[model samples]
Target: MSPRSPREISVLVPPDLAPLYPDDPSRIGPYLVLGRLGQGATGTVYAAVDTASDSPGDRLVVVKVLTSPELDSADAYPALEQRLRALSNTDPTRVVVPLTFDSDANPPWVSMPYLAGERLSHYVTRRGGLGTGKLIALATGLAEGLSALHTRGVAHGSLRPSEVLLESHGPHIMECAVAASAERMRGAGATWLSPERFRGGTATPAADVFAWGAVVAFAGTGRVPFGPGEPEEIAERAAEGSFDLDGLPKGLLPVVGRALDPDPERRPSLREVIGAVIAVWQAENAGEDGATGSPGRDELAHVLEREWQAVEPPARVPQVIRLEGRMSNHRPGRALFLAGSVVVALTLVGGGVWGLARAFGPEEDGALAAADTAGERSSSESPSPEDDPLTMVVRFDPAEQESPATGPWLYTPVEPEGELVRGQGVPTHAEWAERWEAAGEPGLAVIDPEAEVLCAKFCAAPQHLFIDEEGRGTWELTGGDFVDYLSWGPVVIVEVTFAEEAREGDDTPREIVRVTELFTD
Candidate 1:
């Protein structure tokens, strides 16, 4: 027989027909168990209806019953249950938060709002790869969910296609840290595991970043970057950086590439990834007009909503179960298992991973010193005024000393003879405005000819070197090609020029400028 295609094996099994063991509960807490939804090595999930609700049939929820021996500890269930309750109440749109849970039950169970949608894996298999627009929308939602988890010091250790549910509103992230713990205890691994995880490193925010990259790759190409294989083999490939990106969209390559980098320290933060992806989307659609031209948060959300509504609704409403029961006596043989689970969970949530700490160091002191040294070296190696016609050496004014309030140091323009102009501090926008008025707002000049110019043409603009009081700027130079040079030195030389048209804001009309180039050591 020929090998089965993804479409052939991708037939989704209905929840009603999912196998239900005789021991499965008929009822959990305030919910009536309806049918088995799915089962993993560590847990069994079920479709259920809220019996306590006056309108019981209006909506359904899911109940996950953990079977791992590691969760038998007296404290484990309570801690996990409390955390689930907090998450469910915090965000409903981005994540599938638990409505309630009963850690005290014989098999601790969590109830979450039943998502009436297919798993991301199923979607990819059935529909093939998604377009760039939809992928951007999905990535944005997942990034937001991860950001929320990270903000609370929680890491979605297992972020993969199976854990992402595509709903009408947006993509919902399910089974976060707790599921990761369960998988670890069961000795079941995923291809999306970061290289650090394969090396026995603890899970962290960076791990999520790696997994997020993998998820994005899978969604865009309809295949995992490392390809399908035994878990160990896939992990080894990932560690060796053997993934392929042939089918991934060009615009998404940068964000996904940095995310899947073997070194976790090199991966962009979740927030950074979000911004980068959004910028890519905006750039791709730059020719469009009005709201459609630029992809903002609202635009991404709208895309998600539209994609979600296009899919066929599930046959049955999803369910949630509020588990209710008392904690069973601890088993002597389960002590070690429970302890191991606790340690892993704590390591992921508390940011206690040994490799991460060592990679970044306990503090940034060494990194800062290294950056300063590199900056100095770059200055020394720069071309002399005689060799480079455009080269201009500048210094800070001796009389106007730089204070903490003055921000970063500024250099003065030097002549071909190596002559120094009067030193002056890099001024703030307010100070620049004052200087502009003092100089009678003279036309932009290359050389001051007289005293050293305090704030030169580009430097004097609000959007160039200084930000407004609201901490907003027309351009952001944090990531992508702009910040790549920052790794070599502490300072970057950027050339800013005024735009053809000015932007009228609520407070005042401001001169907008474009950042033409960024040069680093």
Candidate 2:
């Protein structure tokens, strides 16, 4: 059977798009730009509709159009456009639809099915990360898609999470176009790039295989393979292949571990990668392993539907924007997409004003809009960190109350243990200290709701980094291990003893409650 474009495919999902900025173009080529979809280093991706099409399948298509370089200079435009044309010419891979390009248009663009759902990056950031089933499903879909593309001699030079869209159906691998020459695409971020790319190798099928490992590793665990840092820092570590596939399950370890092999020759082909993924579930499920494997398209689709229920999209952009009289030639100012190597910024045309209805609500301050789209997402969806400060870290004192190794421990936010447990006569850290002094019986730190409690280590700006979960989160620090005592039941801390520690990039120590675990002092 032939592959169908996303627009030609059927499912239920209305376009979740933000309204165009005053500087954004009303129409690109023949399609009316209904709203902006997302921004990345390549350019602004818009959710647009073709008024001429009466069929629902043909009504909406996503447009990837270039804008001025507030985010990028004009010099790189040709190369980016090359990637666009590269994407447009490819035959549809499994579940990945074909693209349609309009080269004649200024700042040329390509159109594809309007995929509904959050970018993998956004979804991971918002909902922690994918579960085992969905992770397998995602990995399977991507491997299947890439394997098909490789058969056609195409290598998706860039395979970062941003390049993969998590739709209702499954993972859709975008921009699988290879450059006319064998040279690798320059902008694929260093974090996800294979070691060979850093060594000056082109974006070969092998490179894609390596990068695919990085993408899936990131999908299953929100942290990138290598710990977080600046591009230079990450590039240095990535080239050395020093990332931890830590949080991933044992069965799926080889899928990422082997594929991430620095030597391209040693890396498995996409086909082999798919087999490994299947082998994982097949081994566990035993007799039930079917032709399509355990978690296939249907499973992935169901996972998305369940997970996406609470994930309210940023308001919807109209499927059709009236252009009869309101159409204008005002090209959108410049758009920036800094995704991966480059974080994406939206198109912004300054000094122009429009009183149009915005799908994303009121206009953000120009300065704020320049930040990553995650800001837009947070504003539209969840409360800011300022509103809910739940970032924390684990510290193991390993010392008893009597000896109570004298240290900066007292300074940390000890659960004000005026009472025990939750209102169970937990005493304040100070009170506990006083009591420990009296009876030598140490107490837990109870949160003094009256005073502000600060995070000790693993604390940083944009509290989003320290997710409210276990497994020492990606705090951008290069040191420290989580205090692991699994017997603590499902809870990591029923709370803690008070102690002081340093947060990221700060010499000033802050207060944090510590868990009572036996550490060999």
Candidate 3:
């Protein structure tokens, strides 16, 4: 890690977007990773900016991960999703919730707003101990935040000092790093986990309350209540109640002590914790003109501003990046098989379609396909073909022939200009204007091979109007060719130009595809 302050570390050390160590993923979902925010027992968090966000400040998000429904038992996925989404319904004022997530992704990830502040530990270490007023404020805000989570049926499974951010207003809690399928003992480090958790208990709202006490205690004094060591030693000390509650405010002692009770049941509920913290705040500020129950309105806000100014995270995103593409484990590959519209380095057929691969072709389970990692799903934005197609493969039918077919059937996603398809040799805007005088050229949709099934009722090839054998698409004798009727004599490869109607249409242009072109059978 860089020697910069925790907040300053968000600024990218590299000038342009550098590859975050070679081991880091180039892309997660759609978001490109500019730099890694931090890593913990759960997973790595990448700092990425959402350029699409209307407000610049609201764009920074830390993509860690969401619940992995695929890995969960069938009965467990729904419940896990409910819990993760509950993070959103949380009180935004006191909780930084998950902003985006892809449940179908492997090792599913959820992105959360990287709120503006330093870790709680960073603030306590920088300013030494939080004074009585600030401690009461911090305690109240944390308790209320946790209470809100409980209301949504979401327990922040892991609530350590690192999980709390001391912003300008007060402490806001972080999401539980793990997207759990079933409850399990979580994050037992830095002496914040409840004793029940140490002895192997699942995360419960009570466990969260216990962790809250530990975080508050740490803020009051820079020392960990159970002196630092491995998790085992901390658990041992917690059970013995040999706490180092040295500099804690006397008024905060009772409530904090109740919250940290060794037994989960004995620990105060978050509501009780909130009321207790408020009572302490009242006692500490006796004889003041403050209202009875409002602990955080002005008093806490004032304490935060005076004591805990938000340490700006200098997170710089070069352009910005997006990150995911999973619908589910059952069909994680389904999206890949469909028209990704991604350009790949595949050998083109007759210099026509750029990439025609089984990966982008069929939608069957366990069929892995190759695709570029950095970008996904482009509508009009799919990259232009590497080179303008000089030769096209198609099945052609004349305007005089009776065949119902739709599009100019270019193999690449880009539809060629009407003039080029008509063999006019790259006409200019004015040239097109003169040619289009007879008819308006409606834009042709680039037919996606992935989207188009191989077996179709009709197809059209551009007719080059060659006097030689090539111009006659005739299974002909003239053009005996409707693509469906030409199963007899060998299917041939031929190139051609657009008909007058294909070039100028008030509505949609005609579609012409060659299952195989006929040089002339």
Model 2 lDDT tens row, 358-394: 1111111011111122212211232222443432223
Off by over 4 Å in 1: 1-20, 56-59, 69-75, 177-188, 292-296, 315-521
TM-score of model number 2: 0.54
Each model's lDDT comes to 0.51, 0.47, 0.48
Q: What is the lDDT of residue 371 in candidate 1?
A: 11
What is the Cα-based lDDT of residue 24 in candidate 1?
54
Q: How well does candidate 3 score on lDDT at residue 319? A: 34
lDDT by residue (tens digit), candidate 3, 116-231: 55566545644677888778778878888888887887777667765677655667777453432223332235377777777766678988888888888888987678886666
The Cα error of candidate 3 at residue 41, in Å, is 3.2
Which model scores highest in TM-score? Answer: 1
Candidate 1, 315-379: lDDT as tens digits: 54223233344433222222211101000000011111111001110111011100111111222
For residue 367, give model 3's deviation from the true position in Å. 35
Top of the candidates by lDDT: 1
lDDT of candidate model 1 versus the reference: 0.51
lDDT (C-alpha) at residue 97 in model 3? 74
